[model samples]
Target: MKKTPLFAALLGLFGSVVVPIYAQTVSLQPLWESDTTLRTPESVLYYPAQKALYVACINGRPTAENKGSFIAKVGLDGKVIKLRFTENLNSTKGMGILGDKLYVTEMAQVAEISLSTGKVVNRYSIPEAKFLNDIAIDTRKNIIYVTDMGSNRVWSLTNGKAELVVEGAPLQNPNGLLFDNNQVLIGNGDGSLLAVDPATKNVKTLGKVTGGIDGITALGRQAYMVSEWGGKVWHVRADGTTELKLDTTAEKINSADIDYNSDAKVLYVPTFNHNTVKALSLK
Candidate 1:
């Protein structure tokens, strides 16, 4: 049968709709940024129960013995509630919350804090961990995952016992971690995004090279917002395509460990050296 003009017109219209969906790119709209504080904020974790944000501040060097670090509580409207919500920590970096407990990564140990009283309840020391950078919780499995950047290893804690689970080049100084659907998503310091099967420890590369990825939060199923330590943000799509969303390298505004409010489509970014937490709208 011969191709008719009406058929060709319909085909063209269909192509136009499908192409844009696959080619869609993500962009950020600045919503609100918190006022600069004396605390050198490194990561932001959103608490849905209280609808607030918690920031981990490394007051001085990111070392084991630096005891000047603290955590801050911030409102969604970009107001600092308590600059030092918890104090006397050692170079705290990333955070994860489960139930009434908030888990945070210090130089070589993970601290468990009470959400209600804001007090450190217990500490889990990782003997071989060096520069533990990020934390993720497997709520369903009752497991906690953390990345050790200095050791290029990923550790898992179950029943209060921590063990090195994944290591070597595949992790490549892994810095950011997220547990979704029983899978562990990792962002490396060498700009690579990877997915790992927690049960089998099988690893798969998700996308091409990225910046020195610090924090990672899910945008959708396979989509994620990744923050680079050198002040850049990239939106990684399901098909392994990465789009640059924000850059502040020239200003030296470090986009450190980030968190996302999925329901509100908000991305919370902590500027490590700038001492500020910025909320960007993804709507």
Candidate 2:
């Protein structure tokens, strides 16, 4: 059972090979760019079942008056399939899909659309909601969480009612939400990322402050890729370490809400002002 020099050298080589897989920094490269049919595209949702991309287009400023908003459907090959699949929404932003229904945030309301028929089946209004942004769904619990950046609150919807779950500075204008396991992870507009207990509302900070965050996607079990409204993407590790992955602020590519296909290792980003969805490969 004694250790030999050859064994120690082999172990060292193995460590060197494995450590970089977790610690090495990787950059995203553009795979394909979709057509500019999405007006003020703010969020992208990939439907694996249908093999299509759903984009939430704000169309105008994030206000109720911007009734020109709509959702566009695009193919994975960067082709525009439907420019106005669901039209006449009021400043739609984030989106979440549960079952055959697609949930979207529109100003002070959440609209549920039928994925099969492509129609708005129902709308749930939040009495005090202001600037509802990103959304996440806890499928196991049948709960939907939405962020109201202007109101500094996180709204939860269950059984047909919307209620305020958490509010104030710890939220810091929460924008992106992700339901992982039994917890909800949130990315704030003020550049803070946190994990929250849905039932107790206990928050645990996950990463250091970066730029204004807009979308959050899980990179693996221990890390995430956070997109900022300022056109930057950051990688946040489980231990709260962060690294810049992409920066396009100088080119003015506004990285709004993002979606990821874990199986394909692809990242879909909606460019708010640019009116397009860009696909990048994390590999």
- Give TM-scores for every candidate, taking all chains together and pairing residue i with residue i: 0.92, 0.93
Q: What root-mean-square deviation over C-alphas does model 2 reach?
A: 2.9
Candidate 1, residue 74: Cα displacement in angstroms equals 0.4
lDDT of 2 by residue, 38-87 (tens): 88999999889988899999888888798989999899987998898999
Off by more than 4 A, model 1:
1-23
lDDT of 1 by residue, 1-283 (tens): 4658876787788863233332567779999888888368889999888999999999878987799899899999999898888889989998999878889999889999988878999999986877999999999878999999998899998777998788997778889899976788899877988889987989998875556789889876677889898899998888888888999999999999999998788999999889789999985
* Superposition error at 31 for model 1 (Å): 1.5
| Model 1 lDDT, residue 84, Cα | 84
Residue pairs in collision within model 1: none
Instruction: Please give the lDDT score at residue 38 for candidate 2.
Output: 80
Model 1 CA RMSD to the hidden true structure, in angstroms:
3.3
Error of 1 at 45 (Å): 0.5
